[model samples]
Structures are given as structure tokens and as C-alpha cells.
Target: MKTYLQAFDLWEIVNVGIEPPMLRPNPTLAQMRQHNEECAKKTQGDVLPTKQCFRHDLYKNHGL
Candidate 1:
């Protein structure tokens, strides 16, 4: 078994670890801003504000 393992090529093992390039580039800052605006419009006034939602007393009582 040791001899068989030694016979395998090290370069082939290293080459297999390489990752492929991304097919699409990342979204720009403008795209991120547009997405945030859309989400805010959808959720506005329907969801609790972060400050209220994350209050320690609210979590302690509500177990959320």
C-alpha cells in the first residue's frame, strides 16, 4: 500500500485542489442599494423596528 501511494503523482493531487473562476462578477454598490431600497419598501411599517425587536426585555419575555 505504501508503494502504491508513492507511485501517485503529487502535481496531479495539487492541481485537483484548485478552484474554478467565478462565472459572474459581483454586483456593484448601486445594485446593492437598489436591492436594499426594494426590501425596505416591501417591509416598511409591517415589521417592528430593529431597536424594539432586539430589546433584551422583549426577548426575555417572548423567548424569541
Candidate 2:
């Protein structure tokens, strides 16, 4: 058995009804792609795919 206690429940704090600033409202395809690319670049400092990094391994396993 486990027991846990929280300092405050969800109702204890206030939350705004409007969307947070980080969220986008119906972005265009280009806008969405740019946002995704930014996030990917942020994660690794540079964005790269495993396929581009390990071509020999791909050819050995799948001949692709």
C-alpha cells in the first residue's frame, strides 16, 4: 500500500481560461513545420536523421 499527499489540489490554485502563449491557434503547414524544426534543433543543437548518420548499417541490414 502507498499513500501520498499533495500540498495543494488543482482547485487550490488559479488558472486562466485562455490558451497559454506557447500554444498556436491553427497554424499553417509552413508555420507548423517551422515550429517542429525549431523544437528538433533545440533538442540536439543540430537536427540529423539516423539514416543519414548510418548509411552502411542500413545497407547491411535492409539493402535499402
Candidate 3:
């Protein structure tokens, strides 16, 4: 296998696969406020937040 380079100069100012950026451009403050308001209107605080799947649940029901 070809090993990756260890030099730091060429990578000090680059976007690469090894350490990709964490975030991108987000909506403006006004847009975000509008979206949050719309979501709240639809859910009305009655819906409970949930994760897609839990680690324990997956292990318990592995073959189902």
C-alpha cells in the first residue's frame, strides 16, 4: 500500500479527506428563526424527541 505523506507545508492550507471540515455554510439568522418557528407550529411541543436507534436495542434484537 502507498503510504500517505507526512509533510505539513502542502497540507496546512488545504481541504483533504484525512481531516475534512466539520461544517459548511448555514442559513442566515433570519432563515433559521423562521424554520424553527415553522417546526414549533407543526409539533406544538407534543412530539417527543427520539433517536433513530439505540445501541442496546440493536444488540438485543440482532437477528430479528
Candidate 4:
């Protein structure tokens, strides 16, 4: 058998309507290619599967 005591806490019951900031809009195809090139240069490695893949990864990470 289990016995429990119940207490009400306003803070716990309240819903704080906090909204997350808007994400940056999707980048154009050209911007994506440029970003890929920049990333490749920064990493000092060639981009595989074309620049689009790199941009896709970046966009996903940034929540775009």
C-alpha cells in the first residue's frame, strides 16, 4: 500500500508562454555554395558530394 500527500504549487501548474526566436530563412543556392566553399577552406579539405551537401549540413545545424 502507498500513501501520498498532494500539495498545489502555482509555479508548477502555470504555463510560461515562452516562444523561441525565429530561425534564419533558408539561404539561396548560391549562398549555400559559397558557404560550402568557405567551410572547405576553413577545414583545409575538399568538399565531397558537391557543395550542396555541405550547405545542407550547415543549415540543419543552424536550425534553418
Candidate 5:
């Protein structure tokens, strides 16, 4: 059996096997807008939000 490295770096950032400390699915559109507004306030301006950008065709074609 192969042993994995214990150190964390970019490669271990998004491993699915580990539990995320602050991961949650975005809520409905109204809640999303509220969250977006709050995030914009932190940035001190409007930010073009792309949290849920999707390219269904690409994933479908590429077998992602």
C-alpha cells in the first residue's frame, strides 16, 4: 500500500475525501442575492459574481 504525504499544499486544497470546514451549498436566488450583497460590502463595491458559473456542454462533452 502506498502512503500519502502528510503535508498540505495546493495539491491537497480540494481533496474530496477530507471534510470541508466551511462548505455549504448556496441557498435560493433571494438568499444568494443577500449573500452577494454582503460579499460586495466587504469588497467595498459590486463584484461580478461567478460563484455558480456553469458550462454544461463542456462537462458533458469532456466527461468531467
Candidate 6:
């Protein structure tokens, strides 16, 4: 019983102590250029540049 409990603890530690790194997809050059153009068009008429505006534009177009 004691050995079983130790094994359980070790299992818990191994499972919980480390997390796998998250992977993200990299955009291609054309996709990046398109995104930049979209952002520019969205923000073109604005007098001040802001992150909120850029993000809003991005989300408005991309639904993200």
C-alpha cells in the first residue's frame, strides 16, 4: 500500500510538474504582407495610432 501511494505521488509529480510548450503557426510572407496592408487600410484615416484601434481593426476583419 505504501509503495502504491509513492508511485501515485511520483506519477502526479511527473504529470503536473512539467508542461509541454505551446506551438504556434508561423504566417507566410504573403500572409504577413496582407495583414500589414489590412491594418494600414483600417488605420489610414486615423490621426493617432493606437493598439486598440489596430486590434479592433484586426478583430473586425479576422474575427479574432
Give all TM-scores, in the order shown: 0.33, 0.34, 0.30, 0.30, 0.30, 0.32
Q: In angstroms, how far off is 44's CA in candidate 3? A: 1.6
To one decimal, what is the Cα RMSD in angstroms of model 5 from the true structure? 13.6
Quote model 2's TM-score: 0.34
Name every residue pair that clashes in candidate 5.
none
Candidate 6 residue lDDT tens string, 1-64: 3233233333233546754232347978887667556535533433244446777999999999
lDDT tens readout by residue for model 5, 1-64 = 0012212221223444554233258668887666555534543321223212345555777887
Predictions: Cα RMSD each: 19.0, 14.1, 15.0, 21.6, 13.6, 21.2
Model 4 lDDT per residue over 1-64, tens place = 0011001112212334433233358978887676555534533332234457767999999988
Inter-residue clash pairs, candidate 6: none
Best prediction by TM-score:
2
lDDT score for residue 21 of model 2: 29
Q: Ranking under lDDT, best-scoring first?
A: 6, 1, 4, 2, 3, 5
Instruction: List the candidate 5 regions with Cα displacement exceeding 4 Å.
Output: 1-26, 45-64
Point to the candidate with the largest lDDT. 6
lDDT winner between candidates 2 and 4? 4
The model with the greater lDDT, 4 or 6, is: 6
Q: For model 5, what is the C-alpha lDDT against the true structure?
A: 0.40
- Give the per-residue lDDT digits (tens) of candidate 3, residues 1-64: 0111212222312424455223337878887667556535544432232223454567779954
Estimate the TM-score for candidate 1.
0.33
Of models 3 and 5, which has the larger lDDT? 3
Q: lDDT scores for all predictions?
A: 0.48, 0.43, 0.41, 0.43, 0.40, 0.50
Cα RMSD, model 6: 21.2
Candidate closer to the true structure by TM-score (higher is better), 4 or 6: 6
Which regions of candidate 1 deviate over 4 angstroms?
1-25, 47-64
lDDT score, residue 37, model 2? Answer: 59
